[model samples]
Target: MLAIRKATVADCELIHTLAWQTFPETYKDILSPEQSEYMMEWMYSLENLRKQMEEEGHIYFIAYHNDEACGYVSIQQQGENLFHLQKIYVLPSFRGVHCGSFLFHEAVRYIKEIHPTPCVMELNVNRNNKALKFYEHMGMRIVREGDFPIGNGYYMNDYIMELEID
Candidate 1:
């Protein structure tokens, strides 16, 4: 069985571990090694994870299968009724087991729990990512596209996708 629970600051290391395990594999064919390395350090460092949970209002949830952690998702309220799905990743080994969908639904459930109103849930997904279809299947539609700079001369060429929940 799979279970998900809200993560606390104490779980930063766990999230960091999950990111290191999943991010590279997810982007291996799409991102250059240098860009992947830059992103790992930029986003998955423990200090940044702590800052995100403590200072940036991002909430993370962990997915566990048979008591072993396998995936995570994070969400942040960007406006009164708008939320950002910052990240959602599942271990490759768990891909066909519904872990990803569980995480995705948890994010939506979390937003509703906090705001209890009609809202927009948005996420940025690489334009070349295979996950694009997953988002569309989940009912998120592409709203725009952009090349967002992430420092160190790296740019994330992505499509912004959104789902409105009422």
Candidate 2:
């Protein structure tokens, strides 16, 4: 069984590796390799993860199967009623399993506990990713679609999906 829990600074390197490994599949077609590489190092660097984990707006978590880390998800709170799912990933071998769902459930559960009324959960997925259908199946609506500016010359054509809890 896979377990989900808060991630610690000690897990940074593994998380970075996992993010890079999973990211290309998620963005390579939607974004240039240069942009993906830039975004990966800029967004998943050890120092960046360290600060994000230490802060409140960002929530980091790890999925463990028999005590070995296999995946992670990061949620960024925007306001009293808005939370953005910054990233979610699982190692290739663990993809068919519920590792991603386990981490996602943690984010949902946390939002439920932290907010009195149902809040909004948002995320962006590349236009070509079939996972957008999965998000829609999870009840996330297509709120908007736009170009996502990741530093450097890379941009992503993504759908801004939102789920409103009621």
Query: For each candidate, what TM-score against the reference?
Result: 0.99, 0.90
Instruction: Write candidate 1's Cα lDDT for 20-79 as tens digits.
Output: 999999999999999999999988999999999999999999999999999999999888
Could you tell me the TM-score of candidate 2? 0.90
lDDT per residue as tens, model 2, 141-161: 898999877656667788999
For model 2, what is the error of residue 39's alpha carbon versus the real structure, in angstroms, after optimal superposition? 1.1
- Poorest stretch of ten by lDDT in candidate 2: 148-157
- Native-vs-model 1 lDDT? 0.95
Q: Give the Cα error of residue 43 in candidate 2, in Å.
A: 0.9
Residue 110, candidate 2: how far off, in angstroms?
A: 1.2
- For each candidate, what is the lDDT? 0.95, 0.82
